[model samples]
Target chain A: MAIVVVNVMPKPEILDPQGKAVTNAGKRLGHEGFSVRQGKRFEIEVGEVTPTVLEEVRHFAETLLANTVIESFEVCS
Target chain B: MRVGVVTFPGSLDDADARRAISLTGGEPVELWHASDDLRGVDAVILPGGFSYGDYLRCGAIARFAPVMDQIITRANQGLPVLGICNGFQILCEARLLPGALIRNQVQTFTALDQPLRVESTRTAWTSAYWEGQTITIVLKNGEGNYQADPDTIAQLEDEGRVVFRYLGNPNGSLNDIAGITNQRGNVVGLMPHPEHNVDPTITANLDGRPLFTSLADYLLGATC
Candidate 1:
């Protein structure tokens, strides 16, 4: 199965260095209404993928991969 | 003793960490982030920098580097491991230690010589220091604030797990915590850069030398 770990961070309440840089470059490229929030995306190939396994992995990401203080994550197929 | 300095992509202080370990009379071995073997080093130092480009948050992507597999194993076996700044974030990311480093209170990269109070000398890295002794070390990072659930913080405090506290609130960390040691004292993570202050010319007062010296004194029987 294709297991993906998408690291999520808050969308800019305003002032995201990575996002701002992207937006500026996008505007220069003539792509208006472009916005982004910096985040991490990891693709892991595991032995098997199951609901229990997904929950376990989600918990792992919650405690390790993503900071809950200002960040959250989701597991998708 | 031989110490291993693991270099993940974007890691900036690998050389400085090597130099500090060498000055302490311990041989420094270069370990790669994608390798699972430690090459028989006595201890490991995860130097500061934007590992994995600080993607998915600082130290997050690099937490799963192949080297971390062995680091987890060795650290679990009581091998000494010290994580600095970005390295500190990785330790938390890898669950080798506890707590997470959040953004600075002011949300800007703060770089300066910060004074920190040594909270405990029980760890291999801090044994050279006296409890409550304050020393100045350099701090540089955008995401260095430390945050933990209240229960976790209380547990750490009640168990004397906190190892250092910043005299100046450079990052707005909870309890001004600058460093913490695991229950075994074998794994430690701190926000400041002790490796950067190893040289007298760099620190001007040689304040950060004791951390390396103390570790060498314990694991290698050699100290400057």
Candidate 2:
């Protein structure tokens, strides 16, 4: 079995209110000099790890897992 | 005409949508999210709610439901579909519409009887209203802020696809767009709940009834 991981993040230009709020809360809690950007991670286990399967998974990640209009996604093996 | 109101597990306004359809002289049909059948309805309404508990992003998981597959199919074939609030999110996630609804810029859930201006009435759902007509509808959602690429905003504006614009820019949407229609004009997604204001018993003014009546007329006219 092969595990495919995808990270979906808000585009850099889009405002992430949750991440900003968390950043503010973190500063209040005494953390300093750093920022956080929130995102989603999904791990899928596939029965077979053929090149065709990987390509298909990439298509799914692009079309279903992430909306490219305001977000971008990365696939990690 | 029969209007199908889809009931996702967490849909809060399906009944209201059904009632609105009835008040506008159309038959209301209940459709299940887990089933692919549309019951051969003339149109479909994805009512507002936190479907799939809004997990992993709003409408992210629900967009893959079996019913959505068929909805997308029929929508491509010119089915009139209206997505309200969370339904709007689903439409965006399904890529039927062109933008994403993030959290409100103020980071708070906004609830109000907001005024909106009908920017265009060429859509299947807005033909009953005159251009520039103003109406009041219920708006309540945490993730109602709309965002898209600049080019997409220009395209939407150029194509005259923006059907509704907020009079007072409540949620910080780009171009104050409260609602937009697909290129074909048959599918629409909006951040307000028109169904909630369709009846006089619920709302003092029946501003939302025209939206339903518009759809009813469009479908009936198509058959005649």
Each candidate: RMSD:
5.6, 1.8
Instruction: Kindly report the docking quality category of candidate 1.
Output: incorrect
What's the CA error at residue B32 for candidate 2, in Å? 1.1
CAPRI tier of model 2: medium
Q: lDDT tens string, model 1, B1-224?
A: 88899999999999999999887778899999988989988889999999878766788888888889889988998899999999899998888888788777665799998999999998989988899998988899998888877788999999999999989788678888999999998888999998888786555766778888788767754333
Q: Write the residue-wise lDDT of candidate 2 on B1-224 in tens digits.
A: 88999999899999999999988889999999999999989999999999999987788888999999999999998999999999999999998998899999888999999999999898889999999998999999999999999999999999999999999998789999999999999999999999988787766978888889899778877788
Candidate 2 — which residues are off by over 4 angstroms?
A: A46-53
Pick the lDDT winner.
2
Q: Model 1: residues >4 Å from true position, as ranges?
A: A1-65, A68-70, A74-77, B220-224
**TM-score, prediction 2:** 0.93
- Put down candidate 1 lDDT per residue, A1-77, tens digits, no spaces: 55656556643432345565677789999999877666767566766888887887888777666666556677775
Error of 2 at A29 (Å): 2.6
**Residue B21 Cα positional deviation in candidate 1, in Å, after optimal superposition:** 1.1
